[model samples]
Target: MRFLRAAAQALGGGLFLTLFVVFILQVTARFGFNKPLPWTDEAAVVLYVWVILWAAATIVPEREHVVFDLLWNMAPRRVRLGMRIVGNLVVGGLAAVAIPATWDYVHFMQRESTPVLGIPFMWVFLPFVFLMLALVARCAWAVYTALRGQGLEAELHLS
Candidate 1:
């Protein structure tokens, strides 16, 4: 699991760095060289999608994403525990729902290719499917911790 986490972090970080470099290349080519590379924009877009999906999955286990927890923070310990479990379960259910839809959509694109790169369209959505699966696992862990009496505030580092 830790290996997977590390790989996801590296993958996301690398893609983001690639996107940044690609943007710089695009800008320099357009303004400095007066000749833009048409492929750079498409590459940046692809990198952006991969980076965001991996980042979202990485944040889920740590509960580090931006959150509105004012109400959850104010609840009693026992109530917060229940809320934590419920919240995790809800998110897990959402992930469950997303898995099949994502898979089907990806499968539906089997015959298609991306306009710019000519890569299989399904390849673009593989990261989305991976994120959804990771989220499901993270939510399950969150629910387990909550059931063991961990408060939402504490789990999310709000306490």
Candidate 2:
């Protein structure tokens, strides 16, 4: 589990760096050289998708995703646990639905190609599907941990 978390964080970090570099190159080429890299826009967009998705996967284990913790803290212990489980279940269901739907959309887009990148449009959408699936898995794991009486506060060192 620690290895997976480290891997996710490394992947997210690499994607973020790629995005930053691509964006900087794009800006530099367009304004400074009056010529933009043909693949820069598409590459940046794709990198952004990967970064956002992978970052979520990386952060989930760390309990960095946004939550209404104030309300959760005010609730009774049993209520809090129930709410956590229910919330995870709902998120998991949404992810399950999103994965197939997004994949279908990506499949449809596979028939088309991006202008500059010449890559299938599906390439952009596929990462989103993967991201949703990762989120689903992360949610399931969270619920499992909670049920085992291992709350995020205990597992994660927020400081």
Candidate 3:
């Protein structure tokens, strides 16, 4: 599991690094050389989308996610557990329900290519499908842990 997590982080980092390099090239080409590369703009956008979705899905920890924790913090243990279960179920159920349609749409986009670079749209949007799957898996795991009478601890204040 640790190796898997490290690998996931590395993947996100690589995507981000690529995005940054593309951005630098775009800036340099447009200002330094006075000749902008249209392909760089498209590449940067694609990389930016991939990096955000990839990090959210695989690299970011669950505790790092933004949450409305005030009500959770004030709730009793049982209520908190119920809330966790219900919340996870709602999220996971929706993701699960949307998977087929999302897959279909992504698959259908294979024929369409980006305007500048001509990269297939399917490749660009594939990370969104991964994001949805990750959400379903993560929520399911949360629900399972809650059912097992675990993971109902109070949120810790960072400050």
TM-score of each: 0.87, 0.81, 0.96
Give each model's whole-structure lDDT: 0.80, 0.77, 0.94
Positional deviation of residue 144's Cα in model 2 after best superposition, in angstroms: 1.4
Model 1 residue 157 CA deviation (Å) reads 8.0
lDDT agreement of model 2 with the native: 0.77
The lDDT-based order of candidates, best leading, equals 3, 1, 2
Better of 1 and 3 by TM-score: 3
Task: Compare the candidates by TM-score and give the number of the best one.
Answer: 3
* Best model number under lDDT: 3
Ranking the candidates on TM-score from highest down gives 3, 1, 2
Q: Which stretches of candidate 3 lie over 4 Å from their true place?
A: 156-159
**lDDT by residue for model 2 (35-145), tens:** 988789889987887777666655554456555466776677777788878988998988887887778888999899878778888876676776777888878987998
Query: In model 1, which runs have C-alpha deviations exceeding 4 angstroms?
Result: 59-61, 154-159
Question: Candidate 1 on 1-159: residue-level lDDT in tens?
Answer: 789768877877788899999999999999999999988888888788878887877744465667677777678788888887888899899989889988999888878987778878777667888788988988898888888766455334444
Q: Indicate the residue-level lDDT of 82 in model 1.
A: 82
Candidate 1: which pairs clash?
none
Q: How accurate is candidate 1 locally (lDDT)?
A: 0.80
